[model samples]
Target chain A: MSSHAGSVQAGQIQRHKLVDRLYHWVMAVCILTLLATSLLPIIGWKFAWLAIHWVTGLVLTVAVLFHIVRALFFQKPMSMVVDGQDLQNLGSGGRPGKYNLAQKLYHLAIAVLILSGIASGLVMLRKIDTPWWRRDPYWFSDSSWGVIYSAHDFVAMSLVTMIIIHVYFALRPDEWHLTRSMFRGWITPKEYKDHFDPKRWNAEEEA
Target chain B: MIVKDIMAPFELYQPAQLKDAFSLLDSFGKDAWKMAGGYDSLDWFKDRIVRPQAVIDLTGIAEMKGIKETPDGVEIGALTTLSEIENNPIIKAKYRLLADAVSHVASPQIRNHGTIGGNASQNARCLYFRYGLPCYRAGGNTCFADTPEGINREHALFGADRCVAVTSSDGAPALTALDAKFVLQSSSGQRVIGAEEFFVGPNVDILHLTAAKPEEILTTIRLPSAWAGKNFYFEKVADRNVWDFPLVNVAAAISVQNGAIRESRIVVGGVSAVPHRLTQVEGIIQGKALEEGTATLAGQSSTRDARPLNYNGFKIPLMASLVTRAVRNATA
Candidate 1:
């Protein structure tokens, strides 16, 4: 990966690339939209929410697919994987490579929920009419449809809880730098030195 | 995603005589929807989930409209509203458990419109099935609530065939505890079944929740003298005080003789497709007094065979607690 000399200032570390940041924000918007449109109706607020909810679900599914491909092939996937060493660090308090144990676990958990949600949502799409095709409610039997709906609803509820915890941590004063890095695409040299071990995370190298 | 808010037009047949209703059902067969109070049937119609060719209105039948006092016990008309059953002076005095359980169903308005027959014959209340998903109960092969990641906080912990949906009626367990018998009539003849056998699980028949065939109509519910005026306890726990189905409801009747329990029948609802009769727990506390120690043991024994789903593990504990409370209240 070629580091853009013009974009990188002196004494700074690139935590996220421009494309990755765009993907993150786009995914965030889609998830928020999905949650709001799906949950608001259960609490007495009524509108044409089903259409918006399904559309946003499709958008999120596409974004997640892209992120999976990029993270697997173009990025350093090993850095995010939690191993026995990470568990040892819980007691030893050793600095994590790129992500702490909690961060890695949260990422893995969210990934499972999102993928399940997308898969279940795709099965449900057949039950509704779309611009491209007529509705086929019999694509799956009643029992199969029940399983699909249960998974989708369960994933949505879990995401609501996980997202709340994620936002709470992101807004914390101590984690402000990390949240800022998500938006600005870079972290100060001081933040890099203070948070990560240089040997584990070499900022000069490709992701 | 398709919001089916209105029902498709159908022929509505108001039959004043039972013979006319049976003939209509016989001709229409499965295409006929027998409606009592329309509390459960209306939802199915409004959602367009089950579109029938004919709707048979049973409200006009005069023979199935009153509670009659029999020499053995009492026979309640199947079409009696929940409010009518709960407010009946004879039922409140002799069979208070049934009265108490019926009163806890939905709200006053719903009880006013919901009939005992409809409540017993109501469909499973699983969100997936109610939302018109092709679930096991809906003639599909999969059981969503049994999955590792499925939302099953309000699902079954026992007697789950392919579907984990629980029995939604509060009156079912109460009637079961009271050893009630249901009188059903079809075109050919009339048949009687015990309350325990009135309900069918997914294992017995995946498509239907009750034993009543499409042509058969539940005419009367007979409460035998066996359980009348026995020490009774009834409790229902729900998400809302009114207008909500029970998360778990229990009904218990025990006869006490000289500070010792003579016999008891305990049934728990909303934990299985059928009202789960706690026979083992009943055996455990057969000759024992209704004390804390016996109640605790009975409670622990009630959930011994419970196989809870992922999100419904809490139901095991909740059911146990309710059983314990029911046992203690047998004497109170």
Candidate 2:
């Protein structure tokens, strides 16, 4: 598209890059699998959920760690933050930079949930008989195990509601442009202009 | 918010020269639309608001894309992007009000892509008109925005268009205050119209915000030397600090010497079909020492002629304070 323009530069702006999209989809799939494997057995549809859930949770943890590295180094990390402009723009039609306030809140919530689930699950590894670790359920006392299990269970349950909201927004017709942008890495110019403020987002050089 | 998935294929008329542009426009007439920077015309096309048979791309015409100091004053080509006008040292040093307003235009990308001509001649800001309402601006008789249930907090306080949509161009008020003139051209010859007269009332019923004929193109904007090197104040009070259209914006170029006001040009946008100049408010403060209360009084007097709708009464005070603030700034 850039090559086609003789004098006028084309206006299709690049939003998300390849790494961001890949990390997002990988984390999405892993989280869904983990949620299903953990929650499906409560309704009696049981089929070795522990192994699948633990493996998916570990994969999600790794993916999230990779995403953190990428977000910090490769992509624009500042877009995920809440700054002076966000607070100053509390009311009015002012658009947040790259990510809006709601999106930032969602990211913060998911980060907390994921970190808590992983930290607590790592402690509960002593209760499981894995190849690397022996089944030393006695290593931590019942009270300790109860604390770890409680934290893990609470976050795991909270994610069910969180993911529902995420999925609902991702599929909503009004939000289809945003979801499509995640895959294509670009939004229609109209959507980008109408929703995002280029002054804050700084998507283009002169804009 | 494209109502269509793909743009309707049209003949892309890339006119590299003025002669070719005129010929192509003359040939296509109403079916051809002049595209400057493609930010405004493309938006209309992408939104399916207009389906042109041919789009006369003006970016390739190199002669029509620069700012130069003419004998009288500065002459900016119509295709000059807002970024160019906003950053050009000449415009900043001379037309500072225009530069200030240009900087706050719809986001940065739009500033880069939207041209001065496109910004000035773009469509009205009526939400109903854009939503396919059969309003007068949409070439229909009904005024949906004036209805009780219609959202009209930003509708015009003047030019009672059955449409009530005000001119949304941010640069217009500054130009109107500066006494700029638009140089329009067709195949036959070129004509000049004052910035104040370039914008017409809603009685025209054209599906546009300006008085440019369908065949004619705005080629250049010529500013008078009167307002050059003058003290000016530009203020835009949008819902956001940036990236939003103005709820009400004011531009004032007041010549004050020895703490006494001599000449003042106060023009406001987002309040009317055209950038309405506040002659009454200008008169209130003209030749008067702008003491602490004088600017406030001028500001308070700004709402004298405002005929606001049900939901837009806030604009009266908003315009007043903004006018007052602009006067204060100019005085300061």
Which candidate gets the maximum lDDT versus the true structure?
1
> Model 1: number of clashes?
9
lDDT of 1 by residue, B232-296 (tens): 99999899988999999999999998877889999999999989999999999999976899999
* lDDT (Cα, tens digit) per residue for candidate 2, span B23-108: 99888877988888776566567768789999889888888899999889999999899999999999988889889988989899
Query: Residue B308 deviation, candidate 1, in Å?
Result: 0.8
Clashing pairs in 1: A76-A207, A141-B134, A142-B134, A142-B135, A143-B134, A143-B135, A143-B136, A143-B140, A147-B144
Q: Give the chain A TM-score for each candidate.
A: 0.94, 0.89
lDDT of 1 by residue, A86-119 (tens): 8887899887777778899999999899899989
Compose the digit string of candidate 2's lDDT tens values, residues A16-112.
Answer: 7666778899988988898887777544343445667778878888888898898888777888887888877886768767888888989999999
Candidate 2 wrong stretches, greater than 4 Å: A1-207, B204-206
Docking class of 2: incorrect
Error of 2 at B39 (Å): 2.2
Candidate 1 local Cα displacement, residue B119, angstroms? 1.1
Candidate 1, residue A21: how far the Cα is off, in Å: 73
Every model's DockQ, to 2 decimals? 0.01, 0.00
